[model samples]
Target chain A: MKNKLLFSLITFTTLFIMSCKQDLNDLSNETNNASNVKLVGLGIMEISYDMKTIRDYETDFSILSELDLSSVNPSEEKQHVEMVLLESGQLNLTITELNFDKKINIPHEILPDDSPKIMKTEIIGNTANFYDINGKLLGSENIPIPNHRETVDKIKEIGNKFSAEDINKTIATMQGYQFIDNLEEFIRNAPANGVQVLEQGENYVSLRMSFNKIDPRIQGASVLLIDKSINKMVGTRIYDAQDNLVQSVFFGYNKGDVQSLSAIRIEQQTHLPSGSEVKMISISQIENLKFNLNIK
Target chain B: MKNTIFKLVSFFVLFLFAQNILAQRNVAWVHGLDGDAGSWQHYNAIFDAERNINSLRTSYNTDNGITHASNQVKNSMDTFYGSNANNPLNLGIGHSMGGLMIRDVDRLTPSTNKRFGGYVTVTSPNYGAPIANSLMDGSVQNAAANACNKLNDGPLSEIFSLPYGITANLTTNVLCNKFISNDLVQDMIGTPITNYDLRVGSPTIEALKNHTNNSNIPRISIWAQESSPVHWRMFSSSEFNNDQTLVNYVNDAREIYNVFFMLNTSLAMACGVGGFWFPPCWAASALYTYRATQWYKGRSWIDDSENIWNSLIKTTRSEQQTYWAYIWIPCSYPPSLVEEKNPNPNCGQWEWREFTRWVSVNYPSDGLLPKYTQELQNIPTGNRYYVPGANHLEVRNMSNSTLNGQPNDVTKARFNEIFNRPQGDWFRTN
Candidate 1:
């Protein structure tokens, strides 16, 4: 009877050990799956701009107009923006070295100058961490990530299957058509009869493209000046329904094997109610532009 | 064969009993100011549901100083645990001033092998409570005393026909007792010694700061902020509504009296003009004059009623404003993010910007204590849990609907999370 009891105890001990081993194995597999997720590339750029916004409120009475006139002084600031596109379709942006002419005050005891200068986002965690100028972590916030799981899957699939050029195209598309890439597609997709060559130079061609066919609400057209030699858009002008020049963007490119934007200037004019008009002009200079960077 | 079976069953039972004895855990529930062992009756049931855990509801004199109260708690703990009074596995859970008492108990005891394995403070005023400061300054008590005096001697006395005599004394004794019994008034007039110890910058608080929990014992703080407005009873009571209605009726009576006065004045003037030759006209003028004088006197009485009503309304409104300011604050954002006035043309009539500027400040508090005071700097941020919209009492009661943005059971869940307990094992030993 004692021997039989010993055998039962041995069997129970062995089963418990086996179950524990299975749990350890399962934990390791989960860790391995987590390790497979990686950041594919990162884009680093320094943006410095001096923006002046003047708002003029015109009224029938001169006294009323004078009282309503509100304008913001020209403010100069500089920031370093890093865009990290993960292999899991997670895009994170970190802004550092954010300098302003004056300290900006945010509500609830956190002032912009005292707050963390380096702000970064963790895609998988759906959270953002803020660090001071010396890289000491100050705080973290959980941000809502829409379609998180699906985005991760899509990004992993793209990273695994796409070539370097295709990945660059994807990053550029995500950045928007205004930065770089998709120039051929954009030109091809323009209305057949709406595109008209406005001017032609030795190295550049200016084309006027109307967007009436694409969307009826957009009663506007864009005039793009592209460098014919490099097939890169250098400048663009957008007009409103009343044929008023609303926005103008000028892009400067680096002289390198890979065409990259070095500087950009944007000017915008908006008309508000009460006969108010606002004009803003800003110049952003970018540096350290890299493509297909392997980010850890 | 029967002997073998009986011996095996005895051995199994003994092993299980030994396991239970080894796994025994004790949690002492400490109450705050003016509270007793009964204060934890609700939480006692919660902890009782856990296996191998004993709940010790400590009874102490909360009216005295924190040190004295802590001594009482120590005695109770010693009596309950007996030989294991200084057990390192004992846990302490305190609310409000009881938290300070528990800390005092720890401080008085030897540091090595401390009495508490861990400590959890719920809505404890670590840095002291502002209300305590107000009480110590005699402002809250003065307000209550003044209110009581007014109820005894002011317009209320005249209205009830008890004017400066035995009846007035009787009315004062009865009515003032009722006024003093009001929950708000009673809380404001808390015991002096406890209030002094609970005030900010008190010697006890400074001592606690100096001796902070340097031991390796784990500490957790569970604090809440009261986001909801003050209860209606605090500012607008049924008595106030009735008084306002009385004022409106008095104003209506005054208007009627004024009409009669005007009509009587016109008749007196006509009679006086004809009284130069007629005796009946002279009598008629005299009668009209007397009637007008009486109506004017009645109008003056109505004016007195209006004045009293205005005074009461002013006092109540001031109290309401004070209560409102205590729980809420104006927006503190910069001009760029928020404007002083709405700039939208379509909604120019709306005061949305002004409303936001005045009411949008969601400062964290636990009704009685602010977040800053409730959170102990010694405790790590990870260990401190905040439940927004849960007031001081509601946090411990664990019945606040707005606690952690969930209806009922959230407080228990939060407490379980703080204790690192799995579901259905809040106090169970693994």
Candidate 2:
């Protein structure tokens, strides 16, 4: 009787422990309830602004005349206006500073050499005025420079905080950022400073370009560096059996910097949005050139 | 009473013989890079205890590439079972580089009437790892110090001075130079060899690309994928990827055509986020919110390209064009780091803790392999099976082990199906 009772007790203890262990395991799985949750689909949108070239404005600045003037403060001595014009045209502008009011008709003419002449605007005291090359007044406007002293102080503080090296680093990073963010737009609109036929293969034309970087509206002023120093250009362009341009790729490197060559294999695939018709060439690298592909 | 006892003993002996016959599908286990024969002991124990099946372990210093290890696997198998064994051995199971070894053996060995069973590869880097880049140059120092501690013999300087010596062999063995050579095994101890290149057309990479597994042999790929614990790192691109709900139109507008998702179903726990809350959110706030800030943005062009490629490129391939009928088994949990072994026991404990903390801060890896690299896409036969709360090591280690209180042995049922399925019905869905 003693032996039987001892055996029974052992069995009961084992059963109890096993049950407890099972319960604990179930509880743990319950706590980590990732599989139970429904996947929430998310939508992401990207915004990028590309400034028009002088050629763009000269082609048609009629789009500039469509600017909304409702927000302009008539009482303010100086005001700032920023516009992205698709096309340009002539328009009347009036500037009133204290008692003096200046008015002039402005013709939106853009330069072909991709110069900063398109970004020019002048304002003085109560009467702000702009003129053509013939010394004739074209336009005048009254605008308020809000918290002008504070703006000046802020600019001075920034200058103090960032050294020349720091500014250059910031610019370099921004340039890389712009190249990645607006790659297609940059390639389409960018004025190729210099494009030369580097190599002419049997069916392909390799074109090298001295690519120029653009200057956008910095705060309220368009800051364009007028330095015409050239950088070496290198790139490749592939052609098909019919001599049609299949793909083109290029990059500009600063002097003394290491030159790197990259290539992407273009496989035939369907169009993205429509999913109909095969695309002969696909461009995968729009961001950084430093990359690798794992095959097999 | 004596007669009854004798009868029972006879029955038990007969039962053992019968079991041996039934469990004819013996397993030949292969370990990953830098692993020893004892590495798969825990797994072997599981096979013995649960299935009553005996398995042979491949005893090779796993420093050599998969091609070299294939010869070791064949010798080990042949030695364990004589040239003409009455009972046939069929199944092969591998972990990481071990998976490649098995594939190479199967490919090189001519097919016969007595062909083996299919293969199961756990967390194998069939495609190269991006983490390999971190191993190049002096960049290895930038990786987690805890991981570095595992590579060093004594002081860290010893490994640095003589990179290709004992220390380099140990760590270089783990790097799997065939898959990647960019950075991982950066400085070899004493050799003039600075660059280990695994670029296309390189010997090992080219060989790997050329080799393809047979269609008859089925392949089961088990890999881990875990959500990053560094979600609350306020302004980083990682944080932005983690918490899509946190919206700032100004910042959101800049994020183009990308949506990142965590592998596991459970939201990262509040306690996990608590680690970043130190100094009441010093690094966390900056990492999460700051990257989204225009001036401080950190961008990965590779990730950007992946997004565009996934959307634009059609991912369809023919069966004949691909190898490995891969069934991807997903492991959802924090991955395990190195097995604790140090001169000082306390050092091992410290390494584990620090490594765990490091993984929680960085990308969600299988402790050793990243989830992105672990995932294999575009195989026609590829299917997914989800296993939550199981890390890289736990899947192959002892069954009794647990990660975050969830039992690692949950995969036993799947293993049973793979191992004990009726002959020639291994590929059947049921």
Candidate 3:
């Protein structure tokens, strides 16, 4: 009877240890699943880059005219920024340095001598803390968190839900563009979303896409020129519904990494009340870009 | 017979020269909002001094729309010059909203029969006054009054509570009450129809913007910056000094309290040295202690009063700075300087700090209309003249002492300069 009792007790102890191990395994699985879900939510984990933006203005009015903003020399600004997306759906942005080429007279009282050299945002707490280069907290402000994740998700959901044919058709109807092909076949065989191929070359393809469908307020369409070898969009021309060219954008790619963007140039025109037009051109150059970085 | 023929020919030539030189240049001086014909009384006198120039001060209901005022100006010009109303020598010189009215008049006048050879705008809200926007919304005045009240009866009252009645009287009677009773602040409280026309982004101003002025017609704009210290007191009377008497009293009381505290300490030291054994010495020590305690409390009151007084001055200065004109631009980061409700977050926010006024761009103003808006669009930069150290009303007819060796009356000088120029047919002989 004593041998039998000892064997039963040993069996019970073994069962209890196995049940605890199963619970541990289940908890581990849950953690992994949660991490995977977060990864899916944030497609790009982190990005750190230094950006230089140059803005130029051109106007039909006389350069000396106060209304002609072009009289002021083009403004160039450089900044280093690092952004990180956490599993909790919070985005953190750290700006190390920002400098302007033009002489800007900022008040010492407003932007004091002890002003932060490095600024960082804690989105979870909705606070932006300013720090010196030595990482000493100079000041803090309670600000509204920018809904970066939600905005990105909404954009992605819209992109995934709509096919190229449906978007193009909707855009065409709104912008008064006509499609020559039958609607059913066009919907079925369209390769790119919201884009219609205008011409195809050996090394390049020209395509037209409507911006009006995406933003109903913007009554314009964009014509894109893609470089086939690099598989990158190189140039774009934006035209109003009246076929007037309103803006143009050009892109340059990194030589080492064909997929990475190096520089972008955008020129935009705005019509003024005095039957004159003001054109603003901006060029942005990117450097030292690190993708999916662990920024803490 | 030959001498008589030569004399006849010379007389005919001389007569034609006189006609060209002495031709009557008719000028219609128009007034601004809530103004009358008398607005141009001093200006007209100066214009009258010029030879062969006819000055007519035009009066109209400025409370009416700009179009109605423009019609009145046109009718006045017609009556003043009669058959020669459409003469190219006719000129319009307008002040404030009068400038906009003249522009409307030009718009209404047919190009073939140009009523004005040229026009001049003096301290005009050509684009529109930001103050008009504030006045219409009743924000600036209300804000000033609210700030004054808060300083008098809010947290400041509690801070000055130790001094009690005197500090209370100083805040309510001298500082805030005087500020609230300021003429400019009182004037800003009334909302009139003209305020709509004078406001920035108003439909009337938009329409004027859409209708560009005829570039062929010569025009000049005169703007000024307020130099007088009195003008800077937008929310307070000129008599409002820094209340030095109260400051002096507080300083004196603090000194007295220090002396008393030292004396009490000495007495306590004496009592500790066996003076406590005598009843008389003990009673004297207790009385001194009570007196020292009272003086110490008084010292605290003095310190609090000083803080409250400094705060009051700071708050008043801040209020004055808000009403002062400044050129603003978009700014990024350093959020303290930015105005409320940032329109463009991508570029930055609107900067409205007082220091920005001096550092960014000093767009000299007439204590009312900025030089930017005073300048009519498409008007040549050469024609715009800035009168430094002159206020809004001063730009009208008041003399600016800083115009070295030139005529002190900036309005008259600018007018003479425009009319006396040889390019236009309205050229004056003297």
Candidate 4:
């Protein structure tokens, strides 16, 4: 049984390796062809965000200061109103209609006769301490209490409305999105000495070109590995100044109709070591670097 | 044998040393809002010489917002440096929301090993942009609809869809929600947003205000001011607004959106306008005029140490007016020949000359973020480099020194200096 499994694994590895090489060779051939194309629509997406502390309202404190603390005994256990500010806001200060004392849990339904008082309450660095009618130390409520029920409900509503599948679908369609209307002009105005054809075959051609200048943290690389076995362009590799492999980027893109004179699609991925990646779908008319050719 | 062994070991040591010298530090470029990795396309050459620069792309899907983006950045750092407690030394350069992303990185992954040598914010609206109000209040959406209709009448219909995708984003009120909800975005809610909203009721902004940065990492801010008088309308020009593209590929609404400073806390304080409402519109406008004409406070970075660095670029409105008059006005005419009443006062109406004066004394900004917004009260200053006449996007272009017919060597060198320094050593005065 072991021998059979080993044999099967070896065979699978060999087949997988062969298929990858065949795909790369085919792509090399396809790009190497001396195809005249114009640079038209290019879509480069930049994804970034800033992190800030998200405040939850549930555990917030409503300051009810100046407790009476005039009657209870020091030894006897007594209850008092302890408020915590879960989130800083204009909290409608409400006290229980009947001030019962084991421990007052903040109610969600605020009554109209509650007489909403106002105070600039803070959740940081300060806490609320409750005492009995007689001066006895009760528990203290700290700032930044867990989010309120209403706040949690709102978050849930937002979460329910948010569909990862919808988002992913939108992003996938945009990944290979193209604008091939003005390919010729973009290529004509591209930086000079930007393209160098490397290899070619009967039906294909491959070329190396400088898309844009990126900073020097990366050095040493030889060629761009373009994997096009799938419908969209996915990953690309960059070498350092010394022609040694250093970075690899995995992304997504849409291909333009290369057969027709109408448009061309190219997928380029730029990788940041910070794990951020950009998959660009550049669709244009014709193809590759604009070489001198007849326009039909 | 002993001598040979010593020589071999010495050779190995020397080789490693040489490799270290040649290897450059890693640079992560966090782009602005609605920006993908391509946003940093212009500044590529700046670090190509010695540093490896990675452009971090943020998600456009508003649902994820900054919270999700922060997680992505942390994951990227972990992946880049390997999952270990030891993080490689790197410099983080963020523009606009990108800077806030860095702050978010620090917030989310406080324990992560990725050590930032230094952080540089170029024209970052650490405080929220007032234009976000116009966007949220439906003014910008209305304008975009108007602009799209106008553009469609011309050749714009052939290339761009009427009410472009970005315009629709603004109109739908989705993209603005992603921003207004973010805590970092909340930090920048100035001007139009009432003081009650900014101070008493805003939980996120209030939390941010009280939150302290315990780390000792150095932060350097590079801001630009218009050398000449720049009209607000000039921001709509192709050079500053659209990157000279045939189609509107990026959202440049923040540039031209009218920012009403009536509710600005500082301006209110300056004008002595009080209360939740009924501050007297004329009084508020007079205060705004005074604030705009006078040398108002600019951006400052205050760390836990209580250290502060004021804006280095300072040119009074009077000085800027004089310079504009000297260049555009005839030698015989008075400098104030064109008063504020004239639409073309200070020659600001002309888009061709507007680029030269993208920032000015009255409106100190890099044609995107205002200079005054950088100068919040009570924040400790770290390091500041001020460059007048520098556009917002071009602030990161270090290489080529001179491009777009402008000399950027001074600002470029300043950027290089901050990046080249070791962690905790940059922007030190003592």
- Estimated TM-score for each candidate: 0.39, 0.33, 0.39, 0.33
DockQ metric, candidate 4: 0.01
Q: Could you report the DockQ of all the candidates, in the order they appear?
A: 0.00, 0.01, 0.01, 0.01
Interface RMSD of each: 38.6, 32.5, 32.3, 32.0
What is the C-alpha interface RMSD of model 1? 38.6
Worst 10 residues of 2 chain B by lDDT: B257-266
Predicted structure with the largest lDDT when compared to the true one: 3
lDDT of 2 by residue, A211-271 (tens): 1111111111101111012111122233333444333222222223322211111222212
lDDT of 1 by residue, A1-296 (tens): 43343333223222211221122112211111121133333312111112111111122222222111111112233444433433342334344444553331212211011112233222233334445456555444332221122223322433454455645652333232232233333334333434566655555556665544322333556565665455544556666568776555555554545445554445554322123445544444445544332321
Off by over 4 Å in 2: A1-296, B1-23, B84-89, B113-115, B133-210, B229-367, B370-386, B398-405, B408-413, B420-424, B427-430
Candidate 4, A132-232: lDDT as tens digits = 23434322232111122232232233235435453233233332122211112222322332333343223222224331221122122222222212212
lDDT of 3 by residue, A21-140 (tens): 222112211112111022222432455566665544454223322212212233344656555544333444455446554323322121011112333222222334454456565444
Compared with the real two-chain complex, what DockQ does model 3 have? Answer: 0.01
Which DockQ-derived CAPRI band holds candidate 4? incorrect
Candidate order by decreasing lDDT: 3, 1, 4, 2
Interface quality of candidate 2 as DockQ: 0.01
Query: If chain B of candidate 4 is superposed on the true chain B, what is its TM-score?
Result: 0.49
Q: What is the C-alpha lDDT of each candidate?
A: 0.45, 0.31, 0.46, 0.31
The CA-based lDDT of model 3 is what?
Answer: 0.46
Query: Candidate 4 at residue B42, lDDT?
Result: 59
